[model samples]
Target chain A: MFSLLQQAASTAAETDTHAAPANAEAAAAAAAGQGADAAHAVEAAGAAAHAGEAAQSAGMPQLDVSTFGNQIFWLLVTLAVLYWVLSKVALPRIGAIISDRQGAITGDLMQAEEFKKKAKDAEAAYGKALADARTEAGKIIAAQKAEIQTELNTAIDKADAEISARAGESEKRIAAIRDSATADARSVAREVTAELVRAFGGKADEAAIDAAVDARLKGAA
Target chain B: MATEADTGLAFHPMEQFVVKPLFGDGPIYWYTPTNATLWMGLTLLAIIALLVFGTRGRAIIPSRVQSIAEMLYGMVHKMVEDVTGKDGLKYFPFVMTLFCFILFANYLGLLPKSFSTTSQIAVTGVLALMVFVGVTVLGFVKNGTHFLGLFWVNSAPLALRPVLAVIELISYFVRPVSHSIRLAGNVMAGHAVIKVFAAFAAIAWIAPLAVLGIVGVYALEVMVCIIQAYVFTILTCVYLKDALHPSH
Candidate 1:
């Protein structure tokens, strides 16, 4: 690289026709010391060095007064445009978008809270309704049990009365049989007594026989 | 170094900072569009794209570009509020303009062939001067002669107060000069060092180190660029606070 730079400087010194910039003069002097091809390579390097020098400015380009006016002018123009655009359009728009997002989030959170409350309310109502239905069911079951018990007691009482009435009728029938048997016996006894009397040539009294038979049936009973 | 072109290793670092007409070689009028103008215009377009068109959706869920815009907005907004207090918000638009412009200018200047507008002393001087002048005016408007109390050190002993006042007054006046130089100097120094390192690539023995040095400096320059922009803005806010509440 050093050799090539020396070679370019050597040629540029010979070929360069324009006024020498600072670095080029030093390069030209160094090339003079080396003393090589101050020949046709001169033409080749001439254009390049000139272009480079044209691209460069002396000293600090930062302090260049010639460009200051142009820089400041454009700077002011750009700032004005940026300031106008920002203050009027960009800032307000961004602020609004941010606030709008905040509002949307707050609204969503509030809605979620409301739904949670509704769910809680529904749960409570469901529990209350379940309890009420259970109580009503218990009441109905107790009432049905009492009604069945009353019906059973009435049926048993009527059965007992019918059984007692049949027993009384049987008792009366038995008594009547006993009385008829008594009368038959009395007649038989009287007949017997009269037969005995005829055999012994004595007559028996019917009235007296009836009385004795009656008294004997009564004693035997 | 200029003759090193034959070795394919000629690097003019300051040449990159030169302001030239973009169209043709001629005298640059105050209005003639140059590379400086081009980069400045690019900065504006970048700011617009990020802070304007990027936020076109205005979505509740911000896109990447919109989030970046909001982040910048919130950062500067909070800085102003923190330093200058609530009253300072009245000048938020002004402060926002300064921060965004400097930030974009610094970042854009880092491009391969881009010119750094913030690295220009003339430009930073104008920026600092605007802040200094505006704040001074605001101080007087807000608190008449009592604004001068900023220089008067009541905390000092009566015998030492005058000495402190003189120091305060000079430091107060030096604010704009230091403000402008600090930014331009840092950026210009970083860029110039990188260029010098790049020029070393002409020698084979040092080429690797030169490339590494360039990379390292480039990274640092990127950091310095944003930091300088931040420092410039924060200093402005401090000055504004002093003006708004000068009694202390």
Candidate 2:
């Protein structure tokens, strides 16, 4: 297993080294090419100088400028300018944009976390408030129920007392009326008995009958 | 020792190092350095100087210069934020260094006959290696043994485990190749096209073809410069994101 792993590692190393020669060749080509361009420009300038002299003989003052070196120089200068542009200006701006974005994102994440915490707190408070309200409502309901029960009991007791007092008064009045009617009834019965006794005086039993009649009349009156 | 070609091309050097000959390439090359190394060294120095000057006092209320400095910081800061989220902020210095280095190197190469460090595969490979090793190490350090779990992804069913693992491993290993190749290819191809066009102007009297190529490549190179820098930083962010949150 170790050997197999080593083989794999060696293969990877092999691929890495394989790229070296090609890179060196390309670098050589690039460096050599630039040198060749510069030499060509010098040759062209020398040719132009010869041509200008030839033209001057024909009544024209021709100028010969080495576009070759100028181009190379300017190209270099342009590259420098580009480097400065990116390093000093463009990159900095890009960097700023990136940082601002990061700040915004981080700020947003922190803000979201804060909001979530607040929401949780709010939910907890709401739950507590709800529970407290329910408890208070329960207490109020229980107290009211107890109070109503007590009130009903008191009202029932008052009604029972009133009914009993009315019943007592009614009974007393009935007893008094019955007593008066009984007296009236007894007087009528006694008068009828006395009348009847007077009508049959000669035919009635003597001393016993007189005593019974007197006792009954006194009791009836 | 000057060749006819050497007379045409100018001198510019950056940094120097040893190059051991592989197989039959003769003796090893030691620090008989060239212009390429010098420029690379100078590029590094320039970057350091700018950053140092820019961050000297670090005022909350920025001056004109401070604004430019802050802008650079902000750009990298934003890139990290977008790609890596809040955790990216911790890697601000590193990411910024990378962005500035890449941007400066690219721009510097555009100077007349200047060496492009990124044009070389060794340089690109080194950069890619730095990112790869750095990110991988960071992943392991952050997640410990859990980082290995990033390879397996056994979250899938038993039936698919082998296939997914293989695919993930291939992609993971491919990161450095693609990263290095992309930067080096762009730089190389861009310079090559410009060189070819410049050569055409030297050879023949055709104005349109050479001029168009020169102008067009100039514009294209400008875009590539920014794009490559962005690509580098963004990838860094993505790698960092993976490091911080390895589940993905």
Candidate 3:
């Protein structure tokens, strides 16, 4: 099997060498004539060579170009392929990435602006809340002070009424004491004069005597 | 118009200028034309004109000139992307600008009596050296001594590492030489071929040779101009990729 494979490889190599010579000859001939027929003849010769080789090589005939020319040709082809791939696939992706980064920067700026606005609003809200707290506290303190003052005023008025009623009752008690004392004192003196007149048998001018005696007793006391 | 023979092209290498001043003492700097400076100046003017025209008014959608500029931008952008994967995009502008400058210089040289800036070895060498030094500096700056990993082949077995490293080192050092030679050789050879064919046009019997030579050389030169530009840009992309990713 290996020998057969080796023979086949040698034969393939031979056919490739033959095919290249034929193509080169045709290329030289085509290059020689500037006319239209020469162009067709070159193509026809290449086609005929390919056809003849195709029948012998199990449907896989090697190409008929020098390795250097082939390399140069393929270099161009690969370069074009590379250019296409870069232009179509890779470049757009990179451009998108750059655009995305740019968008991110702009978005960050806008977000910062938004956050600044929010912060300002929060500051205003806090200020209003603090102001409202101060006003509410002031109102509460004022209300508390008014309630305390009213209670104090009510207590003072009740204390003054109690003191006034006690003073009036004391005065009435003193007036009663004075009037009773004077009436008792006058009756006691009259009784004392009658007893003296009854005892001494000289009961004349009791009122004058009583008056003189009362005057003399009052002067002595 | 001086022909090749009259232009002293037959002089030995570096004999185009010789000082012999006993007969009439003089300075040649004043009389000798500065081809290098003159061509560079012309290229700069061309670049300025292009930039001025292309960017006269910025548009989201491109005008003709703008589109042409964008097409160039797109070409370099894609080239960088492919050769360097995604990372090479950062150097797109630099690489693209270089490609555009060299390409325009080459294309302009194809015109009658126009100088090819890249045809000169010094110019090509300087540009290649810039790329080489830039890439090397970037590798060192970004990766430090670890950039040597590019040549170390850490993936290789320890036994084979020395050999691989040596080979890679040689190849790495040869990059600038290859790059400069490839561009300079292509441009110089294409121009030389064209010049030879143009000279052949003066002969009657050699008219056919001239025609064939002109057509083939012209066709080939056009391809060479574009390929050299692509190769230069792609190499830049590859070098930048190495700078960015030192392991490979």
Say which candidate scores most in TM-score.
1
Candidate 3 iRMS, in Å? 21.4
Clashing residue pairs for model 1: none
- What lDDT tens digits, residue by residue, belong to model 3 across residues A1-221? 33322322333343333234544344343333323433443353333333223322211121222222322232233334434443454345445544655687899999999999999999999999999999999999999999999999999999989989999998988889977776577667767777777779876566876787678667866
Best candidate, lDDT? 1
Model 3, residue B32: distance off in Å is 9.0
Better of 1 and 2 by lDDT: 1
User: Ten-residue segment with the worst summed lDDT in candidate 3 chain A?
Assistant: A55-64
**Which tens-of-lDDT digit does each residue in B1-248 have in candidate 3?**
13334642321111111111223333223222243344544654565455445545555444776556556656777778887889667666567556766777678777766656576554566668778998999999989999999988877899999999999989888999899879977887677677666666767788788889888988899998988988998898889999989976
Per-residue lDDT tens digits for candidate 1, residues B140-246, read: 99999999999898987999989989999999999999999899888888888888898897789999999999999999998998899899999999999999999
Shift of residue B211 alpha carbon in model 2, Å = 1.7
DockQ of 3: 0.00
Worst 10 residues of 2 chain B by lDDT: B10-19
DockQ of each: 0.30, 0.01, 0.00
Q: lDDT (0-100) at residue B219 of candidate 1?
A: 96
Candidate 3: true contacts recovered, fraction: 0.00
RMSD of each: 9.6, 17.9, 19.4
